[model samples]
Every structure is written in structure tokens, then in C-alpha cells.
Target: MKKILFSLFLLGCSASFAHAHMFWVNVFESDAHQPPHAMVSMGWGHTLPMDDILTDPNSARIGVEKLELYDPALKKTDLIKIKSKITEAEVTNEHFDIFPADLAAQKIALKKDSLPGVYQIGAISKATCYTHYIDNKGRYRIKHKSKDELDNIKEIKGSLKNQSFAKAYITLGKWTNPKPLGHKLEIIPLTDLSNVHVGDMVGVKVLFYGEPQSTSLKNNIYITAGSNTFGLDEGFNLQSFLVEGKAQFRVQSKGQWIINTMKGEDVTKDGKLKDLYGKVDTVYHTASLTFNVK
Candidate 1:
């Protein structure tokens, strides 16, 4: 099946490039003048015109097929089979799948009834992809007859890849500034408990700098602490921190202890970041901590 699809893809390419952006797969025999290989070219639109905007061009994903067998027939058989342990082969699709990669959000406590307004984390944008898919009892149900039909795929088709997704738990209670747009936050350590014990806890007071005075957002700061990385954000706060996304951990291994934090995505270059008010040219978010091991 893979070889068939691959061959079809390669043939499609040379026959006269399918719609420019459509993904193409290639197939070739080992000893053949042109060995089996596939090349992917991303595009902004079907025509691949000069003005088709291209962002992050080199981001590529490749899928390869490798099969191993035991007590081989040694006849260079076209197909290889195994006894009982069945390993499912991976199926590749034309679309690109980019996941959140699990970002860890920390919870920071603030004065009760702080921002006075409620906030909901909803998708401000959707993932515009190439194809749509359905699911069967056990496998993916592709809408088209085969990969060939995908060349003519149209836009505004099916649900946006990651749209209509699960919403973030309502971090109710407002944001004087909806967008947490800012550059360069500060970190101030209140206590020198860098050499604390394993079971110690500390109190850290974080002061957000460049906070717009137009809104009472003094209480919008949230902090997450871990053994090695610490994370701080505005708006939502919770106890459980996500593992896959990096965060800060105040570690106390035996007699050696240290207080540090890890940065989340989007670190701006050296320049002033504009805020909603447009009054403050640069914004700096800071954290102060004091803890004692229990």
C-alpha cells in the first residue's frame, strides 16, 4: 500500500506538478537508476506564486517505512512477514499536525476578587490545514478516494484543523489588559534560602512591572514553582503544573538548594514592547520568593 501510494505520488509530480501546495510522495527500487525517495515542498497556495507568503519554511516532517523479519526466506521477497508480534505500520497523511507540546501553566494567588472581570481562554485563531479526516471504529476515514484526489483540495473545507478544540478552564475574573504582550520581566529573590532542605517551602512575592495603571491588574500575577524550573504568567492560576511544558523548580538536593525559573515560549528581542495602553513602551514582569523547607 505504501509503495503504491508512493509511486502514485511520484508519478503525479512528474506528470505535471499537482496543485503546487499539495504534498507528493515518491517510490523507487533499490537498484533502479532513481531509488525510492520522497520530497516535500510547502506552499502558500496551489499556484506557488511569487507573493504566496512563506513562514518558517524549513519546518519539515518526514515519514519512513522500515520492516524487519526473523528466519528470513532470503529470497529478496517483495513482502516480508512475521510470526505473532504484530507491529502496526504508521500511516502518513498530507496535512501537517502541530500540537501544543504540553505547556505548563502555574497558579499564583492574589487578593480575592482582583480584576473584577471574568476571562475565558478561547481560540483566537484556527489551524488552516490541507485536508480533513474522519475516524472509523479503528482507523482514520479519509474523505477522498485516494491521495490523487487531494491535489485539487480546496480551502475553507472542513473544520479548521485545531479549531473547535477544548477550551482552557475558565480563568474567571478579568484582565485589565487582555493580551499579555510584554518584553523583559524581572526576577527578584527575597530570601537567600538557596541552601535549604528537601522539605522546605517559601513565600515569594512577585511584583509585575510595566503593568498598565489604567486597570486594577495588580493581582493578575500567577506563579508556578518546581524542583528546577519556575513559571510565572498572568490571568490564570492553578496548583497542578503541566509536565511536558517546561517550568521552574526550587530544588533542595540534600544540603544544596537553588531557586530558579524557566521561560515560557516567546522571548522578545532587545526592544521595548508596547502595551494595550500604548503609554508604556517597555514592560517587565518580575517575581520575588521566600520559602522554608518543611
Candidate 2:
């Protein structure tokens, strides 16, 4: 009986060794359009409750949690956990902090060649590694920080691209993570323009980044119709707006402005926009673009 029990213990240890998978994580912005800026963080959503781990040992154990990815349909595609370690002597593209063996982990990549939809991407030693999370239903929520701005959409008629068409500049509002109370778990900034005329094209150009301030960072922007919104996405680096109609306007020169038609609203009124809903405040830097009609 003793010999049989010893053999079983050896077999279990072997299985554990064979199944030792590395744990890791990849940080991403809530919006897919925005690029990822990674930091070793913990907590739910965009709120990083802690700073990155410094001081490397011979080996490190890193655990990835609350990871998320977005699909083209603007949905929380997947979420998963990756826990692993890295030896202090691994070479790679960027000289990032390497977790000593058993401490280094990589972001999982989605494998669509066999299975579709977002899924957990496992890693193999000495092979290309990409880590992704599993798909969850209630992991994400819709976050809009500027509902008052979205209310300022006005009608306009002008010559955009040397052609006559109806136009308007509308704000669809910004979404924040860690959703605030009275906010849906998943919110899409898309606006309904089913009543618009056919052949009309809408353009959505977004600018997001931390602006240098005397004391803190802020999100700022300049727009058409002599409108400017500064410190709008305060403490956050993600911004998304939806405009379903085309607008015709050009920079007259410096501060001067001229619009071909006189039928639009200054969305940012009183130099301030209201925060809608988000549980966790974020800090970010990015610029992105999206153009669509719906």
C-alpha cells in the first residue's frame, strides 16, 4: 500500500508539472479604438487601485484578472485570467519589466482559425503567446459623461465637399467605466438617425490625451460653430461622440470662423459639460477616429 501511494504522489506531481501554465494579463483601454497603455494594476474596470510592481526577484508570480476586449459591434467581447511567471533573463521587443521565471505572463490572443468570438488565449513555452479573456455578460456597462452636450444637436444646410446637403454636429456623450448608479452595464454611444435622408455621411473624429495643466491633467477639444470644450473628460482619457449628419465649415484663419450654413448649435455651452455615469475615474492619452451612419 505504501508503494502504491508513493507512485500516485509521483504521478500527481508529474501531471502538475506538465500542466503548469503561465499566468499573465494585458491592459487595455475601455474603447477598442484607443490604443493600449499597459501598467501592472489591480481592481475592477479602469480603476487601477495600485501602482505597478517594481524590483524584480529571481522569479515572480503575476496574476491577471478583470481583462476585457471589445468586438466590432461595440460589445464586451471577452474576459479572462492569465497567471504566470517569467525568468529575469528573457529578451523581447520592449524592455518591459520581466517577471522572473514563473512570474512573467503574456496577453492571450484570440484564435479565430478554429473557434470564433473572443476566448481565452493560452500560451506555449518558447512559442508566440497572446492572452485573451473569456466572454462575460455583465462585465461591461454603458458610460456617458456628457448627456447635456448630446442635447445640442442642431440642423444645418451647407456645401460640404462642394455639394449641398443637410448637416448637424451632435454629441453622443462619453462613456466611463466602473459605471455609476442609474447607468446600464453596457452603453453604446450610437444615436438613431433612421429618419435622415439617404446618401448622407457622418464623420466622427475623436481626440483624447492628457493636456499639461499647472496642477493636473485634463481632456480638451476645439470644434466647429465656434465651440470649444475644455477639461471635459476630466480624469479620463477616453472620448467618443456621434454625429449622424454632415457639416460644412472651415477654419477661416486662426480664431476666425465661417460656416456655409447658419443652422447648428454650439454643443459645449458655458464652457462645461456634465458627467453622466461611471463608477471608476480613469487617466488616459489617445487620439482616434470613427465614421458611420445608422
Candidate 3:
């Protein structure tokens, strides 16, 4: 049976793979055939990955609401807008056999330059959403179709905290600000972002609303690259708390690295980020940075 409302299933889609927020920045000029611009993307239902976005841009959450470019000095944040697309792929429907089983989202296109120093870019998406899900019995608890699956849905009610996501970082040659971009809860590098090496102890500090607040993060913080996630629920890979507000760790693998805080609070009543339905009194903040070691 064709889904009466295709979007209802979206709210309950599987997200067991998303360990952290990830945004990928691809320098277009890296390939001789590619342009000199940049493309940023995110992924959903999975850990947001850099390489995956290159092959499957549709893995994200459907929009590139904000893409900002910051120079080494952290002087300016230039906003760039990209397109959003929702796509469906035919994966497997052995159980839910009436609709497209796989879904993805993608966004693209931002400007890049030839500046030799370090640079920082951020990609963010926002949404006012409502969801209702019904779980089925046995064999992993599948979901069954319902006549009212698309109707009489209740709005998700809870805390009023909005959510913001960031992805990607890199330090090459010498000079990128690993400092916080002022997200509600952010991770900034006290260690130079532009000079990290394989064995270097890259210093980091957690800030809550622009103030140092690493003590609260305690065991709640996490770091990952590829499928490996460090701390709590697992084990602290190489992480150490230097003080109440700073933590330091080393990267083991090469390629791209992502540093992030676990779901944290966003306590700001600036009145700028109101929810679509009404006022959100509190918000959850997750920050991620993807950079390369090689």
C-alpha cells in the first residue's frame, strides 16, 4: 500500500548510527576537474561522515541552512546557502514492503579561496518537527502500518531547548583557529589547530555559552573518527582533563578527525532561535569538528 503520508515515517526513522554531528567540507580545487569552490554536507541515520558525503550527499538531514566561512583571525562568519534534497532509495522491504525503504538528504555549494593560512567553516541545519511512532512485537520489534498512522498525531512536547549541530575541522601548515565559533556548547582547541601531528597532544577546552565549563562535561564528552567513538559507554581513548575547563587527547588514526561534546545544554534566551510552533525554553547543543591528521 502506498503510504498516505510519506513524511510521517520520517520522524521515526532509524537513527541508531548517529554518534555525533558531522559536516564535510570538500575543497573543489583538490581535483583538477572540480571547481575552486567548496561543498558542505551532513548525514542522518548514521554517524555523519566526511567520506560518505563525498559518495552519498543524500545521507544528511535535508538542508544546509547555514554554512559559514571564517578566516584564521575568526574575524568574520560569511553565510552561504545551499540546496536541500530528500531522496528515497530501494534498499530492502522484506518487512515493510509497500514503500521505499531507504531515505537520505543532501545539501551543497559554498565558496572557497586560495588562502594559505588555516580556515574554519561550519554547516548547520534547523527544523521545527513533530513525530509519532508505534512499535510492533517480536523479532526486534518492527513497526506495523496503521490506518491512523498519518492522522491525529500529537506534537512532541518536552523541554524547549533548541538544537544546533556542527561538523569538521583540520590543521594544516600553520594557522586555523580551533577556538569556539560561539555555539551554545562548543569544543575549542587550546592546542594550535594548524599544527597538529600524529603524536601531538592536541589540547581542547569545552565552553558552555562562551564560558569555560569542562567540569560539567565530566564523563559526558565523546570523540570519534570514522566508527571509533571514545569515552563513557566505551572507554576514554586518550582523553585527559587538564583542569576544570580543559581536556587534551591524541589522535591515533590519520585522514579526518572529529572532536565533539556529547549532547549539552543551550541556555540562551536571546529570542533569536524560537521554534516553529512556539517558544522553546531550553535547547540541546552538540558541536563537532572534522579535521585531517595527514
Candidate 4:
């Protein structure tokens, strides 16, 4: 049993490593005579500015819990309820035990004439996965699908302890909100980005469970803009852990930006837990938000 379990996990690892998948909303100007709308796409890519990654058949089937279009101009928020298409097939990935893994939003209409102001839109998942896996020196990072390769596969039993949040920003015609959404782990803005420009500093706060994340160790927080990953600029990815629940940073570029927060939690209290592979389960959580600069 032990050998079979290990072999299955080994096969899983070789086939996939947890890839970086992010939720994002793409905005485009309505062709001359159409109502403005947006496409909520869950993209798979190496990092931020997911401009070049695959879309369409986009990704996932998780039901969207909250998809709100916050209009600062009118201080009115519209809730867009999305229907998730759950396939009859089961996907036994690191994230989904035996359920299908493909929930996402198609296109949706926005508030009419919602231009010339700063607008915030985001989607929270009502359906979350309790993923189980191992965490070993980043070697066993849960891959979307494990591959078949022989490398130093570091790992230990684990599960996901975080919820997924996808946020976005827009400037329809000059108004702003700049208020935090108070997510469990939120990377919300503290400054208005409706009319931001280059050389202008847009402030942001990182909150874990509604409070500040102590320390700004780059690792705990990853700020990325199109083509420019903050890790390369800062080097080492700020390996320190988020000591406090509060963290803050500023955007220094003009483009679509995605801020991702990752941290591990010790789930040892629940007592003796083991995965199918007979290893103790440890878990970590991740949260992300996106906005445009200028």
C-alpha cells in the first residue's frame, strides 16, 4: 500500500507541479456602438501581465460567490451571479479530490455609461477545494497536473487553507473608491488609481484575515506588472515569512498589475493527519488581486 501510494504521488509529481493560476477580468472598449462588458478569465501562466497566456475554454468551473461591479460615481454596486458548469467527469488533481476542476465566468455586462470613473470588480469563490499534497523545499509545489520526471521531489502531506479572491480595477470616467474590501487575505488598494500616471506611487495594503500582515518580506508579497516581476528586481523574492498580518507596498509602473500573497499555516492542532501517501498533511494559503496603473 505504501509503495503504491508513493508511486501514485511520484507519477503525479512528474506529470505536474502546482502551476501559477490566477483569476483576472479583461476589459475592452465596446466597439463604437455596444454596451461595455468584461471577461473574467482564469489564466495559467508564469507570472503577472497574463496577456499572453491561454484564454477561452479559459479555466475552472468553480461557482463565483461574489461578482460585484462597484461604481464609485454612483456609489452603487451591482451583483452579477454566475452559474458554474460542473462537468460530470471528475478531476483528481492536487486541488480537486474527485470533482471536476473547471469553473469560471463567461462575459458579463457592466453598469451602463460606467465610464470616466474608477470602478472595482471582483469575484470570490463560493466553491473552494480542500487540496491535499506535500510541501518540500518548493519541490513538491502542487502542480495542476503532475508530470513524469525524476528530479529532487521534496514534499510532505498538505492541504489548502486559503480562499481564492480575484480583484480588478477600472477607470470609466474619473471617480474613485480606494477602499479595502476586507477579504480574509486582501491585497486591496489604499489610494485611488482612477487617474494614476507613471512616477506616481499608488499605495496598497496587505491584510490577512482583516488585519495588516506584519513585515513586507517580498516572499509574503509578490507585486508584478506586465513583463516585470518584482522578484527579479528585488532578488531572492524576499524569503522571509509574513510575521505580522499586515503588509504594504506601492506600484511603480503603468500597466495591469497583479499582487499575489502566499503563506503557509501549521495545521498540526487538528491532530494526526495523513494523506493517501501516509505523510502528515501541512497546508498553505494564497490570495491575489489585480488593478491597472494609469
Best by lDDT: 4
lDDT of each: 0.23, 0.22, 0.44, 0.47
lDDT of 1 by residue, 1-294 (tens): 433333333332222112112211111112122222111111121221111222312211111121111111111111121111222224435775332211111222223333333221211112221223333333322231222344333331221111111111112232222222121232233233322455444333222333322111332233333321121112111121222221234443332111222121211344332121212211222221222233
TM-score of 2: 0.18
Per-residue lDDT for 1-294 in model 3, tens only?
112222322321211113322444432113233323333444432342432321222222434566676665666665545434333344646574222322122222223444445556666555322222332321111122222233333332222222445645432345645556776666666766544567667767777677765433333444333324333124223434435667777766554456655443333445445332233323345555555564
User: Judged by TM-score relative to the true structure, which candidate is superior, 1 or 4?
Assistant: 4
- lDDT: which is higher, 1 or 3? 3
Q: Give the Å shift of residue 293 in candidate 2.
A: 24
State the weakest 10-residue window (summed lDDT) of model 4.
232-241
Sequence-dependent TM-score of model 3: 0.56
**Residue-level lDDT tens digits of model 2 in 48-85:** 22223312232112233233433322344333333433
Better of 3 and 4 by TM-score: 3
Over 4 Å off in model 3, which ranges?
1-62, 75-80, 88-116, 127-162, 167-173, 176-179, 217-243, 265-282
> Highest TM-score, which number?
3
Model 1 residue 189 distance off true place after TM-score fit, in angstroms: 1.8
- How would you encode candidate 4's per-residue C-alpha lDDT over 1-294 as one tens digit per residue? 433433443332222212344445544333344566556554324454442222223232234567676665436465545345444434456664443333333565656654555666666655333333344455324422222222345543333323456677655555565566656656676566555555655555667677766544343343333323444223222222344443344455656555566544444534432231222233334556665556
